[model samples]
Target: MSAPDPKTPDDDPLVTQARLRRERHERWLREGDMSIGRRLAQIGVLGWIFVAPTLAGLFIGRWLDARHGTGIFWSAPLMLLGLCLGGWSAWKWMNSR
Candidate 1:
């Protein structure tokens, strides 16, 4: 096979710049420098994670109240417990990284 062509600084500027930009982006991703949009999305995910269990508890408690004829007695405590559990779960997720 013939020898490969030598590369020089005189390479096309556009190609060089594109390659450099790609490298920089790869480095940023590797370094875990998430973009603002991505960070916001993650925050949204965390918010959902924190809210789902609480809402579920509320609904379930409401069902129990309807069944057992109890007022806020069951709903209130369950809601609080769900809130605490969700908060703990979210905290663990946030800190796990």
Candidate 2:
């Protein structure tokens, strides 16, 4: 009788699971886990990514309001726009990782 091919979809599920696990283990051994400090640094970067643009928007809006004497009209919308932009940027950055 001919032996079953391991590469075939009909191969044993347990054997497939074991092979996947072994591959994952080998990959983990090659690339170590993320350190606590590295994780914290990533968090900080994300925070800045979200905050910097928002703050810049607020300041610029305020400046424009001061120039035109609009009294919060420009400031409010600009700040909201900044918030949306920052949020979108942060979301994209997170997804890329």
Candidate 3:
């Protein structure tokens, strides 16, 4: 007769989720709640992350349009591209935290 394989309890999804939740709760208790100032700072940083790339794209697009005399053609597309880049960057930053 073949011996039965041993199953690891930690491999279960529910067990993993409970473990994560407990760790997070412990960390929160250890660190205390986030201050209002800290939250505001985080918000500011997120805004800057989303805005900087967009403004850069707009400025560059404007310069290109002016140099090539293409009216608003380049500016519009570049601005949209910049907005997308900024949004993606902000999303990634949020997820990392």
TM-score to native of every candidate shown: 0.67, 0.70, 0.83
TM-score of 2: 0.70
Error of 1 at 32 (Å): 5.4
Which residue pairs overlap in candidate 3's backbone? none
RMSD (Cα, Å) for all candidates, in order, is 12.5, 7.4, 2.8
After superposition, the stretches of candidate 1 with alpha carbons farther than 4 Å from their true spots are: 1-29
Cα lDDT of model 1 by residue, 1-94, tens digit = 9999887765979888989889888998889777899999999999998998899889888889989999987898888888988999999999
Cα error, residue 11 of model 3, in Å, equals: 4.7
Ranking by TM-score: 3, 2, 1
Question: What's the lDDT for all of these models?
Answer: 0.88, 0.90, 0.94
Clashes of each: 0, 0, 0
lDDT of 2 at 91: 99
Of candidate 3, the 10-residue stretch with the lowest lDDT total is 3-12
Candidates 1 and 2 compared: the better one by lDDT is 2
Kindly list the per-residue Cα lDDT of model 2 for residues 1-97, writing each as its tens digit: 9987557654879878889889888988998788999999999999998998888899999999999999998888888898999999999999876
Error of 1 at 89 (Å): 0.4
